[model samples]
Target: MTTNSTEKRAVRTSVLRASFLYADGATRLTDKYHTSPIKIAKSFPLKDQLAVIVMDASPGLLEGDCYELDWQAREFSHAYITNQSYMKVHPSSTSEEAMGSSISQTFRLGDNAIIEHMPEPVMLYKDAKLHSTTSVHLGPGSVWMQAEVICPGRTLRNEQFQYAELRSSLSVYYGDELIFAQRQRVVPGQHQLAAPGCWGEMTHMASFCLFTDQLTSSQIGLIKQLVDDLPATGDHQVVVGISETERYGLVAVAASTAAWPLQEAMRYLWNHARNIVLRKESVYFMYS
Candidate 1:
């Protein structure tokens, strides 16, 4: 009946020390959220930043849990961000705070800067409700690749997030203006996953994206092949699609999480993209 109650509310925020100039150069530095969630720092030697990572301070989130993160990149910086794993939202009970929640983030990249973000999936517990939003900005000659996964409750445990409502949105901006945005809202009780043309058939769900500079002919071929492998069935599909924005970059999005054959197919697609960039014969990092 109230936004705050006797239930103990726990929170932490911190920005880790951003390292720089060292030869070994810091690849990553965890700010330790439970210890501190806000007042963070920028990892130095950031001339070409690589990834901005945010994580829950605890092992997992419980009812009434709230997390927030924000990041920025200077001109010509580059960074790639990847989450640790699937984020689970533990259910709440009548005994105490039968509620769990989280918030969105704003990410910025300056001129000639780049950022690659891939956060683990956020799970919605049975009878849970929450909202999420993300905004990203990039400059010229910049690149980024990201992926997200969402599971239907914990399938291995025979759990279902029934009677839950979740909404998530992600937007990208460039040249001081809005460029791309997508949002997803799922309310199982009021809405239906199997009503007509919605989910109707699948259980687990996921979404993956690759945003970066122009790809070679070889790269294009690999992407096309992966799309062709999507399950012929409309309901059992991976929702594979490609887009070219900003006149100099391309993005690949694939969503799927079927049992085996489909799961393996998704893995193959991920490997294909990673291989292309890591295996470049004479590739170079511009900021260096």
Candidate 2:
């Protein structure tokens, strides 16, 4: 794997790679590799599946820092991957050139394999810049679910939308055919994100994507009902929309004035999708 940083100066570069395989009756961490600031914190068995957490030792991503992560789930294997804390992007100094920070992730799933990737929200500090990309490849009968939340900035400090720039891209391919692709760029100074066609009055946003062949019309209806039941009052208010992709998948997006509403909505949809596709119950994650 290669770092995606374009900085000319020396910076921290790290990589974490892991592979999960199924044998006998359970999925196991077959092979793993990692570098500084990012490593597999631990793994625990969840029935017949496995749950792994990746931790970043550093406080946050600094200017010119780059991280690469790759994971593969073998045929029939099931695994859930998550992060320990928020993906905090530190600000770049105005006195020097801003190389910013970047993170690249790749996931591959074999036939009938299942992977649930649920990372914490991303926090952008004032004047921070970040570039993130995720690529996924799915085999026949496989299922992949990913949820992401993005914060404008430190809202408590009245620094909302103060980031210099944020670029994010996601591409999902079923075998050799591309089924879904999304690209987003946010530069507060250049765009009116609060406009009607943009983010409007929302300050935080979240996205949940589920790719599976087991989705049925009944399941989709149930998911919609779950979203409709969310509170739309006071601090719990959230605007959510769910739609099916061109292929075998669905995407749900939510926006709110705060992060908690969006997180709650996404989690609800995530758990519902897991039950429909994997015939498994929700397993709550404990965050420190």
Q: What is the C-alpha lDDT of each candidate?
A: 0.53, 0.87
Candidate 1 residue-wise lDDT, 160-263, digit = tens = 54726678897776666666777888877667777676765566665555554444667756766666765464455566566555533445554454433334
Please identify model 2 stretches exceeding 4 Å from their true place: 1-7, 95-97, 231-234, 286-288
**C-alpha RMSD values across all candidates:** 6.8, 4.0
Instruction: Please report, as a residue range, the 10-residue window in candidate 1 with the lowest summed lDDT.
Output: 279-288
Q: For candidate 2, lDDT tens digit of each residue in 188-256?
A: 988999888898888999999998766787877777677778755575568889898888888888888
In model 1, which runs have C-alpha deviations exceeding 4 angstroms?
1-55, 92-99, 161-163, 212-222, 229-271, 274-288
Best by lDDT: 2
